[model samples]
Target: MPGKSLSERIADFGRRLAVEAHAAWLAARDPRTPWPARLLALAVAAYALSPIDLVPDFIPVLGWIDDLILVPAGLILVRRLIPRALWSEFHAVAAAASKHPSSRAGMAMVLLAWAAILYIVYWSVRVAPVH
Candidate 1:
């Protein structure tokens, strides 16, 4: 790190951030996760994974604030909600998984899951019991 250029350090930080976000996603999906923790982790994962930033990078200092602050804060909250042992396991799994090549099948499954969830929500609302 001492001899690394600024860009190299930034790239390293980005990689670590991706690993953390992946870990949160894993924790969110795990059945053993407490309901509150799962909900929070899901929120964090969604926010982190989103391509649109709250403040666009063109905005200079303000844009990086959300990336450097909000995501890490959310990750911290999620880490606290999960038990230490479980979080460590999740982090390890996520780190190992990150080394693997990206999977289109995994992407399709996630999209399918979200579509199913949306359909269920719509169906329930369309048939709500209003006595």
Candidate 2:
């Protein structure tokens, strides 16, 4: 395939990351998984998705550092929790999903719609007079 647009690449990476994170979380929570590992994965996911952050995204390169740290850390914690067999199974699934082709056009359309909605909301807020 030809070179992908930045947005498409980002979206594809985001989707794959989400898939891997979800698998890791599930494996960590399996009954066969150790309680300590499960708890750690839960905590990590919560922190990663939380609105509050140690470093805000507006801070240049540092903004994304949390993501780099959190994701791998969470996976490591999960691996420690789950059995080797189960983890191997989940890893296979995640690998398959990553190899699957992503629909760039569909993702772009969804992003555009979201942007349009946000723009409309911003326009309305700006034009509305304070009571």
Candidate 3:
């Protein structure tokens, strides 16, 4: 990691963030997680996973703002809300889980959803009769 290039380091950071976000999602649903922390964790995970953005990524300057600011802020807030020991446990669990690896099922699902949305929009705009 010390020898890694800037781009590689950034990528590593991104991967870690993804793993932690997933862990937060898991913690959010756990029966043992405190209610306040659970709510915060849920919000963090939802915002991170959401395809739709508070500021759409297409817009200049502001588009990437939420990604740059909101998700990390939410994660930080969640960190404070959860007990330290519990947070450490979740972090280790998340790190180990990240190592196990998985397929692109979530990506496939997202693609399918986007395709459906696009089809509906196209059908309504092109096929439906207008005034």
lDDT winner? 1
Q: In TM-score terms, which candidate is top?
A: 1
All candidates: TM-score: 0.70, 0.52, 0.67
Question: Considering lDDT, which of the candidate structures 1 and 3 is the better prediction for this target?
Answer: 1
The whole-model lDDT of each prediction reads 0.81, 0.64, 0.75
Output the better candidate (1/2) by lDDT.
Answer: 1
lDDT of 1 by residue, 20-131 (tens): 8888888989999998999888877776776655556689899899789988999999999999999999899989983623434335545666778889999999999987
- State the lDDT at 34 in candidate 2: 70
Per-residue lDDT of model 3, residues 8-118, tens digit only: 887897787777777787778788889999988877776676656655689998988777777788888888888888888888888787353332433455466678888
Pairs with steric clashes in candidate 1: none
Ranking by lDDT: 1, 3, 2
Q: What digit string (tens of lDDT, one per residue) describes model 2 on residues 3-30? A: 9999998888767666666566555456
Mark the regions of model 2 whose C-alpha exceeds 4 Å error after superposition. 88-131
| Rank list by TM-score | 1, 3, 2
Q: Point out the higher-scoring one by TM-score: 1 or 3.
A: 1
Give the range where candidate 2 is weakest over 10 consecutive residues by summed lDDT: 98-107
Show pairs that collide, candidate 2. none
lDDT of 1 at 13: 88
